[model samples]
Target: MKKVEVIQDFPEVELVGRKLGPFKEGEEVEMRPWEASVLEERDFVRPVRDFSLTGVRKALIREEKSSRLEELPSSFYRTVSREVRRLREGGEVEKAEELEEAIESLVDFRIQKLARMIISSVDLGDIPAEEQVLANFLSQPLTVWEGSIGRVFEKNIDKEVGVHAKKVRRNI
Candidate 1:
C-alpha cells in the first residue's frame, strides 16, 4: 500500500484517489471539485494477481497422481479432525460449526476438482478468491485430476464415523 496522504478534516477518501483533483504535495483540493478529477497514468497503481499459486501447488499435487488424491480427502479430514480436536479439547464447540464449514468447502473443492465439475460444484457467482485464483494457469488434466482415486476421495469425504470418531457421515 502506498503511503496514504492525510487530507485534513475529510475523514474519508475517494476510491482510486479520483476525487482529489489537481493535487500537489501541499495543495488544498476542494472536496466538491475533487469528484471528477482525472488521474494521470503515472498515478495509477496496478493491481497484482498471483498466477503461480493455483497452477504450481495444483500441479505439484497432481504430479503425485492417484496416491495424492487418495490421500487428499483423508488429509483434509485429518487436518479438520486435528483442529476440531484442539478446539473441542480447548472447549470451543461453540465455533465448531464454522470450522466444519471450512473443512467442507476444502474437501468439496477437491471432490469437485477431481470430478471435473467445479463449474457446478460451487456457486459461480463467487469470484475466485484466494491463492487458488491462479487456477487459470493450469493445463486441463492438471486442472482436473481423475481416476479411481477421485472415487476414493468422493468415498472418503463421507466416510462412516466410528462410535468415538470425531467425524460422522451424517448429511450436511
Candidate 2:
C-alpha cells in the first residue's frame, strides 16, 4: 500500500472491478500500489512520500560509517529504482547515473555484511524486507552445506570408533 494525494477532483472510478474514490483535489488517501500507479500515470494523483536522491546519499553515508548493515525503509529499493527510471525518462541522465552509483555502493556494502551474517549464523534483526528475503534465500544453501559437513564428521567419527574396536578385539 502507498499513500497518494489526489491532484484533481473526480467521481468514483471503477478500476479492475473495484470502485476507488470520489476524490477531491487536496485529498490524501491510501491505495493499493497498483491503484496509485494507475492514478499517478493519469495525472490524477502523486505519491505523498517520495524517496529522493538526497535520502539515498544519506543512507549510503550511514552504511559506509557503520560496521553492520544499516536498516532501510521497506520501499527503499523499489522507490529508488522507480526514481532512477523516472529520471532517465525525464532526461535527467546525470542525476540518474549518480543515484544508481550510490545505490550500487550501498548494495555492495550490505551484501558484504549479509555474507558475514550468514557465515556467523547471526540474526537479521533490522534489515529491510527485501534484504531479508535475499538473506533467507542465501541461507538455504548454507544450511545444506552445514548438514553435509556434519554428515562427513559423523562418518569420520564412526570410522575412528570402528578402528579402535578392531584393535581392542585383536588385543583381547
Candidate 3:
C-alpha cells in the first residue's frame, strides 16, 4: 500500500470487498496501489510524493546517478522536475525540502533492496526471477556483479555467463 492525497471530493468506493473513502479534497489516505491508480486516472487523487517538488528533483538526481534515468520515459521525470521548479520559485521551500527528504529515503530503500538481491544472488549462485526482472527494468547490467562474484564460484566460466545461461534456459 502507498499513501495518496485526494485531489477532489470522492464518494465511497468498494475495493477488494472493503469500503474505502468518501474522501474530502486534501485528505491523505493509505490505499492499495490498484486503488490509487484508479483514483489517479480520474485526477481525483495523487501520490503523496507528487505534492513535493524537491522530492521529485532528488529522485531524478538519484536515478541519473544510478544510470536508471533512461529506464523511465523522459516525459515523466521532465514533468515532475518542471513542477518542482515551479513550486520552488513559488516559495514553497519548506514543503519542497520535506518532500525531497521523503523521496531520498524511498530511493535509498530501493537501492538497498537491489544491493541485497545482488549479494544474495551471488551467494546462492542463482538469481530469482523477480530480481532479474527488476534488474533488467532498472537497466542494471548483470555485469555489474561480475567483479564481486566473478571468481568466487569454482566454475571456469564467469558468474555473469553462468547467470545468463540460467536465465536463457528458464525463459526457454
Who wins the TM-score comparison? Answer: 2
* Ten contiguous residues with the weakest lDDT in model 1: 44-53
The pairs that clash in candidate 2 are none
Worst 10 residues of 2 by lDDT: 163-172
| Shift in Å, residue 39, candidate 2 | 32
Q: Write the per-residue lDDT of candidate 2 for residues 75-167, one digit (tens) a residue.
A: 788889999999999999999999999889889999999989998988879777789898999999988988898777666666878756544
Candidate 1 lDDT by residue in tens digits, 1-172: 2222223223234666543433444333333322323222234221121112242244334534532232232133344466667777888876565566555544455544544434334332322233134334333445355445565665666465444333543422
What's the TM-score of each model vs. the native? 0.25, 0.60, 0.34
Poorly placed runs, candidate 3 (over 4 Å): 1-79, 118-172
Task: Write model 3 residue lDDT over 1-172, tens digit each, in one string.
Answer: 9899898999998877989889999999998899899889989998776435554556556655663221322244344556657768999877766665665654465556566555445331233344445666644555554544554542444455765554444210
Relative to the unseen true structure, what is the C-alpha lDDT of residue 4 in candidate 1, on a scale of 0 to 100? 27
Question: What are the RMSD figures for all models against the true structure?
Answer: 19.1, 11.0, 12.3
Ranking 1 against 3 by lDDT, winner? 3
lDDT of 3 at 21: 84
Whole-model Cα lDDT of every candidate shown, in order:
0.41, 0.85, 0.62
Segments in model 2 whose C-alpha atoms lie over 4 Å from true places? 1-50, 160-172
Better of 1 and 2 by TM-score: 2
Instruction: Work out how many backbone clashes candidate 1 has.
Output: 1
Give the per-residue Cα lDDT of candidate 3 at 134. 67
Clashing residue pairs in candidate 1 (N, C-alpha, C atoms within 3 angstroms):
19-34
